[model samples]
Target: MTTYLKDLTQSIGYLEAQVVSLLGAKNLASMRGKGKLNMLYDP
Candidate 1:
């Protein structure tokens, strides 16, 4: 039972890392567009 719990925790951690990586990629794309817009307006 303890080993099962440990395996479950590791699986959850792996899923969380995948979610974070996906979000980071999306955020980077959004930020790149926003940065260009800001430069255009602020310059």
Candidate 2:
């Protein structure tokens, strides 16, 4: 029972990290686009 709990916790942690990494990459891409737009519009 204890080993199973440990495995479950580890799996959950791994999933959380993957989600965070994916979100970070998506946000970075969005920011990159905004930066390009700013450069194009600046006088």
Candidate 3:
């Protein structure tokens, strides 16, 4: 029972980290896209 609980907690932590990283990556991608747009539009 204790071992199972530990594994469950570990899995949840890993999932949370994965989600955070994915969000960060998406934000970074959008930022890069905006930079590209600025470069194209700016005089």
Candidate 4:
């Protein structure tokens, strides 16, 4: 059970990184560096 919990956390982190990279790539590709990917998170 402990191993399962650890794996779950790791998987969630990996998934979030993949999603963020994909979104950031698209944004960066379109803007060509006019804005930052982190801006998506900031208000």
- Number of the predicted model whose TM-score against the real structure is largest: 1
Give the runs in model 3 whose Cα sits over 4 Å from its true position: 36-43
lDDT of 4 by residue, 1-43 (tens): 9999999999999999999999989877776665676667656
lDDT by residue (1-43, candidate 1, tens digit) is 9999999999999999999999989877887878876545553
TM-score, structure 3 vs. true:
0.66
Clashes of 1: 0
Ranking by TM-score: 1, 2, 3, 4
Cα lDDT computed for each candidate against the true fold: 0.86, 0.87, 0.87, 0.85
Candidate 4 global Cα RMSD: 5.1
Off by over 4 Å in 4: 33-43
Question: Per-residue lDDT of 1-43 in model 2, one digit per residue for the tens?
Answer: 9999999999999999999999989877877878876645555
In model 1, how large is the Cα lDDT of residue 36?
75
Span of 10 residues, lowest total lDDT, candidate 2: 34-43
Q: In candidate 3, list every pair of residues with a backbone clash.
A: none
Poorest stretch of ten by lDDT in candidate 1? 34-43
List CA RMSD, all candidates.
Answer: 5.0, 5.9, 6.4, 5.1
Model 3 Cα shift for residue 7 (angstroms) = 0.2
Kindly list the per-residue Cα lDDT of model 3 for residues 1-43, writing each as its tens digit: 9999999999999999999999989877877878876656555
Compare candidates 3 and 4 on lDDT and give the better one: 3
Error of 3 at 42 (Å): 21
